[model samples]
Every structure is written in structure tokens, then in C-alpha cells.
Target: MGSAREALLDAAYEAIVSGDWAGARMADLAARAGVSRQTLYNEFGNRDQLAAALALREAERFRALTGQAAREAEGDAGAATAAAVTAALTAALDNPLIKATLTDDTSGLLPYLTTRSAAIMDVFREDSVAIFVERWPDLALRPDVTAEVGWICETAFRLVISHLIVATEPVETTSRHIAEVVRRLMRDLTTT
Candidate 1:
């Protein structure tokens, strides 16, 4: 990404966080980014595209954080799972854009994180499965187990999204429970 594009995205995020996405004009965002409105349009095509790009960028950041947490957990798959979930939930709690979108329905940015999140979900699932296979190479040797691993990754990602939208427990408690369930599931699959 060029500096101009980065600036535009930063400005868009700030605008959405401070107010509503629907109320944010292209010209205003461009001015905030220190670029022309035409430049913003050239980079993003339109507001919807810009919004999608911003949402994807944020998702990627979360993905990177979770991946890093998993990698830093040494050789313990359960510990890696726990660390990844904790990192995601903790980051979501502090993300102003997430808070803004969840609280303000009129933001027009909710779909990118919720109902229309297929792209984000797909990337997360793929990355998660890769992480699992890398940590537990035996899973990749069995087709059935690999499929189960994908399902588990999808389930874990959905659980994280659910917690982000509606929290029932503390981050630590939720993450620990998820890790325990995942560990049991993996154990059963491996032992079978």
C-alpha cells in the first residue's frame, strides 16, 4: 500500500470510529487524509469499497496478532489455541471500530463484520487450519482428520465472532473454555 492509500484508510477508520460511516463524506475523508477526493476514489472506487477494505485490513491485523500468539506458544497446541483466542478477544474489546459498529446500527459497517463476513471468515479458517497442521503434522496425514481440523477451526472462529458480538463471560474464561473444548476434540480425533 502506498502512503496515500494508508493515509486514506487511517482517515476513514478515524471518521468511522468518531462518527458513523454513512455520515462520512468522501471529500471530508480525503481532506483528513491530506489527499484529494479524486485520489480517495481512485484508490477505493467508492465508499462501500473503502469500507470493505478497512474491515479487511482490521481483520488481517487481528489474524496476524492471533497467528503470532499461536506461534509464540512454543510446542503446546492447547496453549497456542488459548493464546490465539485470548489475543483476538482482547484486541476486539479494545477496538474502537468494532465498538462503534456493534453499538451504532446505522454505521453501515456492521455487515462487513457480521452477515457479509465470508471473505474474512474464509481467510481466518484457512490460516487457522494451516497453523494447526503446522503444529500437529499428523493431522495432515489423514484426510478425515484434516477435514475435522478445518471444521474445528471454523467453529473456533465463529465462537470468537460470537463472543465479540455478545459477550457472556470474561475473555480469559471464554478463551480457556474454547481451548479446553478444542483440546478435547483434537485428542479424540487423534486417538480414534
Candidate 2:
């Protein structure tokens, strides 16, 4: 079932990247995945559901990459934050789905990354807070500080998303600026 689901998602991804999502029939996708149409509907329920699932899967991929970047710079909070932002922005720049959505989203898929992005935002915020708490466990000792950490995480994540949508500067400059802002914010939060 898992393999079938993955294959279906892979097929969906290809269709979306090719600007054929609006015309991609479930039967076609099912055939592309070498599965029956019933199996596709059983796995994802409907076309909209399948689109949401694909968006969610991509969000998880971004979360994983960002988390790994943070972990790699475990000892330095600023460096970790910077690395995470860099990874996200870099990935977004290279991601075909993102490019497709940003350029010409005929599949009505922009909502998954914009107005309807609460779930995606939650994924990034939760993972980022976990990373912060891991690095500075002292944050766990204070409930208020922990909440602030979540806010900081959301802010940083939103900044990266903004850069992904409309780039006014290079990834390096934006990432460094966000990192500096996070460092200042953290200093204020931790000192008091």
C-alpha cells in the first residue's frame, strides 16, 4: 500500500511539474502508477485530497531538510538558524513544484502554499521549536520562554517563505539578516 501510495504521489508530482495537473485524470494517474483507479481513490479519496497530500508531502520534505540543517549546526544557535533558512530557500529555488506554482499554477495549487498553509506552517514551527528546545533545554524550564520560542520559529519560517515567494536579495544576504535578527531576539528572550 505504501509503495502504491508513493508511486501515485510520484505520478502526481510529475503531472503537476509538467503543468498538466488541471487535466490529469485520476484514471491516468492510477495507470501511470500501475495501480487501479479504485486504489488511487482508496488511497487519497479525491482529486483535491490528492493535491493536498502532495503539498503536505512537499512540506514535510522541506521540514526534513531544514531540520537536518539545524542539526548539523547544533552547537551554535545563530548558525543553525541561518543554515535552516539557507536550506529552505535553496530548496525552494530548485524545487520544480515551487517553480511551477510560482510561475503558472493552473491546478489551483497556490492555496496549499499560501492562504491554506496552516498545516504546512505548523510543521515548520513545531520542528523549529523542537530544535531550539534541544539546543537550549533551559527553554523547557520556562513555559513563557517556550511559547516565545515558537513565535520566533514561526517568524523565521515566514521570512523564509516570503523570500521564496518574492526575492529582493540573494539567499545568503537574506538568510544572514534573518539569522542576525533571530540572534538578537534570542538574546533578549534568554537574558530576561
Best by TM-score: 2
Tens digits of per-residue lDDT for model 2, 123-164: 999999899888888898999999999998888877887888
- Candidate 1 per-residue lDDT, tens place, 113-144, comes to 77888888887888888898888788889998
lDDT of 2 at 123: 95
TM-score against truth, every candidate: 0.90, 0.93
Per-model clash counts, in order, read 0, 0
Which one wins on lDDT? 2
Q: Against the unseen true structure, what C-alpha lDDT does each candidate score?
A: 0.86, 0.88
Model 2 Cα displacement at 33 (Å)?
1.2
Model 2 alpha-carbon miss at residue 183, Å: 1.9
- The 10-residue segment of model 1 with minimum total lDDT is 71-80
In terms of TM-score, how similar is model 1 to the real structure? Answer: 0.90
